[model samples]
Target: MRKFRKDNLVVEIYENRIEMGNSAAEDIADKIKELLAQKDEVRMIFAAAPSQDDMTSNLVKISGIDWNRVIAFHMDEYIGLPRDAEQRFGNYLKKRIFELLPFKEIHYIDNGESDPERICTDYLKKLNEASIDIICMGIGENGHIAFNDPPVADFNDSKLVKIVKLDDVCRQQQVNDGCFKSIEEVPKEAITLTIPVFKRAHNLFCVVPGITKAKAVKRTLEGKISTECPATIIREHHSAKLFLDQDSASLLK
Candidate 1:
């Protein structure tokens, strides 16, 4: 593994996604342990994607974490998927980590809500109830963090969560991840936690792997911080660590 710092962000490159995931999960587990020592509960937000599979799987295997004192929340969910659809972000996280661990609370963004705005307001209330301690996230193939695609991301976003229209590249990525059969099958709209929400988190652990993310990873580390590549914003975060595998870091100079 190799490590470096870019502004306030720490970057770690590992031999493969498995190694990267293991290190990231270990670091997060340590953080959780540390926080639990200081407080009664630890609140975290998670990103659901195939890219996070290794990390989430490893996280559940690690001992010493008091899962009973952890409160869980997912970062985004599709706007129109059926209640039981496997493609829904909530369901994805449910299978990945939510059910694997016994968390104190698990707040899912209801994708089947009849009113998007109403659900956003409701979720915002839940988020604001306490300060978020950590965010486990990933960069999209288009350099988006969460579902805040370039076109919709706002660094100074006023809302904690809101609805967004998925850009072409973002929709295509769902297909590339095998979450949907085709771009047409992907939901064009989603409810996502805004950039400001991530900025407010105490720590951010962004795990991004795979060759398909090379360009996005390059942009996030080397490009000027801008919404054009929303992930670039992490460079300014005070306690953010980006974990990458060789294939994902291939385009980095």
Candidate 2:
């Protein structure tokens, strides 16, 4: 592994995606164990994407995590997809880790009632009820965090959760990831936790792989701290680490 620091963010480049994912899982598992030792339960928010596959898969296999004491939340969800839609972030997590573990609670964002405002208000309340202990996330090909695409990301966003339109690149990424058949099939709007929520989290573990992410990874580490590259904000986080494999780190200097 080649490790270095970019501002407050720690970046680790591994030989392969499997190694990168395993390393991130070990670190995240350690954080969860440490937090559970200090508190009654650990509140965690996760991002659902194909990029997170290896990490989530390995994370669930690690022993001694006390999964029953973990409370789960997903970072974002499409606004109009069916509850059982495979493309739904909530469902993605449910299949990946939520259902595999015995979490104390799994709060899902529901925008199906045609009332995105109410969904945001409800999710915000749940999030505000406790401090987020950790965030397991991935950056989009367009440098987005969660669904906070460049056009809509706000560094000073006051709302904990809000509905926003997905940018063209962000929508195209769904098709690229095979989550949707085409850009036209992707939902244009989504409910996402704001950037402030990420900044406020106690710890962040971002696992990004694939050659498709190389440019975004480069921007995240070298670009200015601005909403234009929302993931760049992770550099300002006190306890954030970015994991990458050769494919994703190819463009980094």
Task: Give lDDT per model, in order.
Answer: 0.95, 0.94
Report the C-alpha lDDT of model 1 over 1-253, residue by residue, as the tens digit: 8999999999999999999999999999999999999999999999999999999999999998999999999999998888899999999999989999999999999934699999999999999999999999999999999999998899999888999999999999999999889888998899999999999899999999999999999999999999999999999999999999999999999
lDDT tens digits by residue: candidate 2, 41-132: 99999999999999999999999999889999999989888888899988889899989999999998973566899989988989999899
All candidates' TM-scores? 0.99, 0.98
- Steric clash pairs (candidate 1): none
Candidate 2 TM-score, true structure as reference: 0.98
RMSD of 2: 0.9
Candidate 1: where is the Cα deviation over 4 Å?
A: none
**Stretches of candidate 2 above 4 Å error?**
none
Q: What lDDT score goes with residue 213 in model 1?
A: 98
